[model samples]
Target: MGGRRRHARPASADDLLSQLGRLTARVREEIEVQRARVELAEALQRGMLPSTLPTAPGLRVAARYAPARSGLDIGGDWYDGFRLSDGTLAFSVGDVQGHDVEAAAYMGQVRIVLRAVAAMGAADPGEILRTTNDLLVATDNPLFATCLFLRFDPRTWTVRTSRAGHTGAVWARADGMCGVIEHAEEEIGLPLAVMAGEAYPVTEYRFTQPGALALLTDGVVEGPRFPLEEGLAAVARVLRDGVAEEPETLADRVMEVAECTGHSDDAAVLVLSHDGPEACQTAGAAPGIV
Candidate 1:
């Protein structure tokens, strides 16, 4: 018993090799699967966004979209320039919860249906919400969405807007005053896809000629280190920073400011500046530049 002998089974080299080979194959397949999932996810997110923004006569619209840190967090941020059959221009900005394919797909569906509802000459933000809600109530997993809908009738430079669960809008007049239109008393209305029968009332806010209104998601107003108020002040400060005039330049300035300030969330901003007949000839001025 002093020296015990250990019994051992003969090793099977070929069997071990086969096992290693199978493991490698399995890993390769898994990688491929992951790659495909990413590709599909990107496609879905891209699909949710507009392939090309629509053009509406007598209206100048500019938008900037930023996906969350990863492309996958793309979520449901979207901007639509709706052209009604009656010659009205409708614009909306919305955010859905997920960046997955389903969110992207539903985002597309919501935009189409909502645009139709808003185009019915019912320029009510609340009405658009209600009608869109009716259609989505049928969806079992109906996703949730927050939107700010604005409609402008070239007949009048005045624009009417309604907000859902989204952030309130800031209108900085040509005279240099900044006012936040609290989401209508109706701003508290539930988002679409939740309660189908819920009644949403539209609170109307009018912009005088030569006024500018900004419609945006929380991502814009809730940037790093700043609550809604700070983010908004930043926006106004940047807008009045003495430099951007072209519609595109204004949009770019806001986006860059948000990004530079460490706004990690997907930031999207849609700014509409209405220049009365006087400023129309040269809309390219930069008190709004970055």
Candidate 2:
């Protein structure tokens, strides 16, 4: 019978200590690498967002964002408001289908492409989304995003908007009544990058009175413990009760509701309010895709 030779363990504590030290160093290096990746991803995400929301007379706008609480990778929620070439204000909120560094990068690409296409003078919300979806599909990217796009015409006090598989937007009447946009579910198109030639039907509404609009990512409404419909109702309640607050204050109140729920996903909110046509100047900015 052949006896198996026993391998000798380290003869000295110093040798064991040296090996442990090497292992610790490797662990520390890995931690640093991970930290760097997280920082870079956050930078990419923040950079993609508007540094400051575009402003116009009569329209008070504000936006807020919070990253996911438990993930090493960042979420893909983003909100943007900017002036279009045609003098109309374009606003959007979107969530890319991922929670990683790659998702953040893809979000940047999608936001840039959407902005570019809108800048090309596409006034119709449906056409804006159609062009953006086509362009993103041409890139052959695997990620898709749900977006809500709104083109607000101060001239007419009307909003021509479109949804691409996004969470419904909320609006509040000047009298403190609020609800999710009418027929939001019925008009939703497939998320961007889902189909090359998808048509997003335009849903138009005129602000017959001084009112407020809210566009939010799902994180603002849904959480691990919160049902989606309940969350939406909660947010709408906040908007309805807080309609008298300034746009910034109202936005903060809406976010507070999400925070109270211990939401685990990334969140973004864009709030726009007008006192009325009498109080705000006629400014136009048109067309945005999520």
Highest TM-score model number: 2
Q: Give the range where candidate 2 is weakest over 10 consecutive residues by summed lDDT.
A: 281-290
Model 1 regions more than 4 Å off: 1-36, 51-58, 184-186, 242-244, 277-290
Q: List the residue pairs that clash in candidate 2.
A: 87-284, 87-285, 88-284, 88-285, 88-286, 89-285
Report the Cα lDDT for residue 88, model 2: 90
Provide the clash count, candidate 1.
5
Local accuracy of candidate 1 as per-residue lDDT tens digits, 232-287: 77777655552226557778877776665565556677777665554433454222
Indicate which candidate wins on lDDT. Answer: 2
Q: Give each model a TM-score.
A: 0.78, 0.88
Predicted candidate 2 versus true structure: per-residue lDDT over 145-221, tens digit per residue: 99999998867666888999998888877676788885545578999999998989988766655677889998888
Tell me the spans in candidate 2 whose CA falls farther than 4 Å from its real position: 1-20, 184-186, 278-290
